[model samples]
Target: MEFFFYAVPSLMIAGFAAAAYLLVRRARRLRRTWTHGLTAEARCLRMFTTAGGGGGDTSVHTTVHHVYEFTTREGRTVRFEEENGPTTVLEGDFVTVRYLPELPQRATALPPTPGRLAVGTGVGLVFLGIAGSFCVGFILLVHVIFAESDGLLP
Candidate 1:
């Protein structure tokens, strides 16, 4: 019973850790593909701000609006808006964008600094933490059920 408790939690933690590792790896691959393959030109159109409150906390967020213009190899011009933080980008600046070769509207503006990588890391960690919590809960439940069956409950 004791061994089951330890083993189940350990396995759960390991599983979450593995998932986090895989997610980070995938994000890295996506970053590489965006950096090397897709190419487009865009201009920062404006900056926008919005505020919202929920539960008990209020917060405001800023987004830099941008318009990307590019021509497909088939000779069709495409344009779209992209929202990002103004701190990392500015208005009236020409920015490089990467889009899906087939879906020009789906794109991202590459940050000048590698700071975006840090953001990606933070996001990955958040996802890992949530998954880890669920896994740990499940393991605890399993341990409790099995221990009870073995008359080990106290």
Candidate 2:
């Protein structure tokens, strides 16, 4: 009981922190890739969509992904896939590619948009809410279990 009292809440808080850190790091990486990365023209090789988790009355979601290839300034050809693309993009269409100088394969077909970043932000918020509620519930349960006869409620 004592271990559960402390460990679970600590884990929950740590999870919340990790999620926030990941989202922020992604935003920063996208910003840097847009500002400092080299650009080349890439031809979309394929486009596909996979349905997200769904069952038992849960609504299904889908994500679009694309694979493209471009040659770097050094003449090395690289292929990469990205999940976020405009709806108008189609296989065989040419799109702008941004890639890191040192790692030509690290590329994105589209720059980070406010809408894409907002989706990550929203996901982080939902995770925070879940972890926060768990921690709050833990505190209340501990208080009730260890409360004196004086009664916190009274």
Candidate 3:
């Protein structure tokens, strides 16, 4: 029981930290690739919106998805579809895309956005808040238990 109290909280903290680390790592990598990679104009072939997550609520949040195609430096063409957040890219619009020279498939139509960073930070904060609550509860419980055992509490 004592081991569980410490081990569970430790595991939860580690899990949250690892998730945040991965999110930050991926965002950094995407930003670096966008900054250093080759850029080209891609034509958006189609655009669509899909409702995400929410159901039974009148206000359903939707995400815009766009399909784009661009010709690489080597004369090869590549097509990719990605979520464009709230901004909608119209079909036939020539949007800028950045891609690696060696792996053209690793590309993004937009630079690294702040949404991922914000989400990671929010998750970490929420985890910390929960862990802090657990810690406070544990400390209070230990104090009460010890006081009662010693007959210090009337």
* Model 1 Cα lDDT, one tens digit per residue, 55-142: 4565654445555566656677777776554555666777777766766666667554446776878887898898788877877787
Candidate 3 structure quality by residue, lDDT tens digits, 42-123:
9989889888666676677777888889999999999988785336568888888888888677678876666766686667
Give the TM-score of each candidate.
Answer: 0.53, 0.78, 0.62
**Candidate 3, residue 97: CA error in Å?**
0.5
Tell me the spans in candidate 1 whose CA falls farther than 4 Å from its real position.
1-26, 45-47, 53-55, 85-93, 112-119, 142-154
For model 1, state the Cα shift of residue 153 in Å: 12
Candidates ranked by TM-score: 2, 3, 1
Clashing pairs in 3: none
lDDT of candidate 3? 0.75
What is the lDDT of every predicted structure here?
A: 0.68, 0.81, 0.75
Best by TM-score: 2
Question: Which of the predicted structures, 2 or 3, would earn the higher lDDT when compared with the native?
Answer: 2
Shift of residue 97 alpha carbon in model 1, Å: 2.1
Model 3 spans with C-alpha error above 4 angstroms: 1-11, 55-59, 85-88, 111-154
Candidate numbers sorted by lDDT from highest down? 2, 3, 1
lDDT of 2: 0.81
Candidate 2 global Cα RMSD: 3.9
